[model samples]
Target chain A: MTVFTLINISLLAILVATALTVSRLRALYEAAMLSALFSLVTACLFVLLDAVDVAFTEAAVGVGISTVLLLGGLALTRSREAVTPRRRRLPGAAVAILAGGTLVYASQDLPAFGSADSPVQRHPLTDTYLHQSQEDIGIPNTVTSVLASYRGLDTLGELLVVFTAGVAVLALLGPLAHPVDARRRDDLDLVDYRVLRVISAMLMPFILLFALYVLFHGDFGPGGGFQAGVIFAAGFVLYGLVFGLDKAQQVVPRVVLWALIPFGLLLYLGVGVVNMLLGGSFLDYDTLSSDPAAGQHLGILLVESAIGITVAAVMTTVFFSFANRRATR
Target chain B: MIGTHYVYWLLFALMMIGLYVVISHGNLLKKLIGLTLFQVGVFLFFISIGKVDGGSAPIVSDDVETYSHPLPQVLILTAIVVGVATLAVGLGLAVRIFETYGTVEEEDVLERDTTP
Candidate 1:
């Protein structure tokens, strides 16, 4: 076998090893850590594919933020608990098998691996962005153009979904600051949580800075509202993790969340309302202004900011629920 | 022959094992492991779909100008992040469940919780 082929095989083998390790891990904490490593490897594979934006999201969401949240959540519960397997496993099995079969069938019809000229690579949409994006959108990254301008409506739905998730979390929790049993409340040594405190103190600024950079730098690269929004929320999540939920909640008060919910929702809706009021149809930015490009940029910016606010607010709310489930109000 | 496609076969096998773990394992943490393995199966499938034999790195270099489409790789990366986030949320929920119930098994936790 060629050296390249050997390396690919090795990579695949490592992936299998990681999967096995996850299954065999007796400790919950170690399993989470190993899974985090697996995520890192998956992200590395993305980098090799030239998918830079996806790589960034994977790194931030998977290895960096999610792992922290899981570990923190684990701290609130049992560290290691043995639980036996249960019966009634057939329905899920059948579905998974059916799904697997369909997936295998789908793979059969796909073009052979690494075909130089696939339909997707040679599509008109690609050539349109590659050739004309500079003069039209004036963006460096084609992904931005597609996600922000071409497929903006879909992104709006995603933002709305995030906001809805926040509301759902709040609804599920019932009321804010309702008391649960004292024993259920985690009793990790708050005073001794020196590592978390120190790390948050160090990371909080860089996280926010990076979020902002991603927010604005999106037009020039593989970023925009969704990625930036998620990252910004991740920063607050970090704070919640380190400083304890109460302290983190203090920084981002309930009033802010209450206000932001409507504000973000209104901001996104208002843009569409404005568009309807103008000469164009709903969300049709031609009515936004005389210069279409200017209108597109404005629409993208306002919508993106709204998305960021809603995402940050909703994620904080979700984490808040996890911290204190008695939020009835 | 398609029958000799080791990568595809491996992917399906891992997928089955993951599904089995998720269904049979009573522990909350085990469910997460199963969920991850399942996700890894998807990731592998996507990567394999994007694989080009003799396909050099997607990065633009002086010597070689041609490269495979980098879009799928990018999508997979984002998918990885989303997968991790879901896992984190899942684990966090498991932790909270454990704290309240003092057990990580789904059946045990369900037995204690009232409908009210």
Candidate 2:
């Protein structure tokens, strides 16, 4: 077996082990941490599969943001899962086994792993996306080209879905309860950690800067707005964890977040509308400049920035909503 | 050969474990974690399908002869973001449920609802 295949199998085994452990754990906090480990392993597997962009995103969102969100949810609620009678386990196991059996049966017809002759690899559009994109979009990263241009409408929808989820969470949780006085000794914020405070304070600017670099460097590498936005939110989240949510809010207040929640979606829509006005189909960037490739580049940058804005704002808002809630026993 | 399709089998097993957790677990947070596992399993399946032998990442490079399919990566990319968004919403609901019913266990919440 090749080294890559060996690595792939090993990672998949780790993922399975983590998933099983997560399922068996009754401690919600431990389960959440294991889930983070699961995401970390999954990101590694994605890299092995030659999906660096997806791997980058999975690491940022799944490992970083999702873990923190899970922990925050755990803090707001109970940490231990309640025990129940085991009599009902039969049905769940039966259903899972039956469904899994069906999948295994169906898998007999699937293309072998890493086979070059798979239908997906053989499809005409694959060639177009991999080759034609260079001439048409003039971008080095085909994933970015397809995401920001060819499937721009789908991404716009995805952005809307994210925005809607943010709005829904905000409505459900309500706004952050008024920030308690910073000087008050409270368990909510880590006011006593001198080292964490100093270190995080030193790291905050670089974190934000790295996020911006990821956003702009996507055309040439393995990141884009989604990953960058999550990284950005994670930076603020780190700041909040150490310094306190109130300080984080002082930097990016609630009003600004509310405005930003829809601004990115609106900006994306406005770009499309402008494109229509310029005598091109909606979201066709060719009309944005005399040179089509340059226009495509400009349009992608704007839309990616718009995506970054909405995602960063929504993620921070969601984190704040969860963090600011008063824990009720 | 088993070697050719072992990944699929393993992924299906992982997905089934997630399914079992979602169904059998009473804790809302546990269910969400299960849901995440299930989603990630699916993501891996999609990404694995897009892989080509001896291919590199989809970033265009003259040195690389083959590139893994970018379409699936793009689809799963958005799906990951949406998955997290859904998770946030689910967690929010769990918190609200805990506030109203005083527990995140499904059976307890149902018992309380019926008793009231």
As a whole number from 0 to 100, the lDDT of residue A11 in candidate 2 is 94
lDDT of each: 0.64, 0.91
Candidate 2 wrongly placed segments (more than 4 Å): A176-185
DockQ of 1: 0.31
For model 1 chain A, give the 10-residue run with minimal summed lDDT.
A180-189
Give the per-residue lDDT digits (tens) of candidate 2, residues A290-316: 999999999999999999999999999
DockQ each: 0.31, 0.89
Q: In model 1, where do residues sit more than 4 Å from their true spots? A: A1-8, A76-106, A174-203, A325-329, B1-14, B43-102, B109-116
lDDT for B37 (candidate 2): 95
Tens-place lDDT per residue, model 2, B9-33, is 9999999999999998889999999
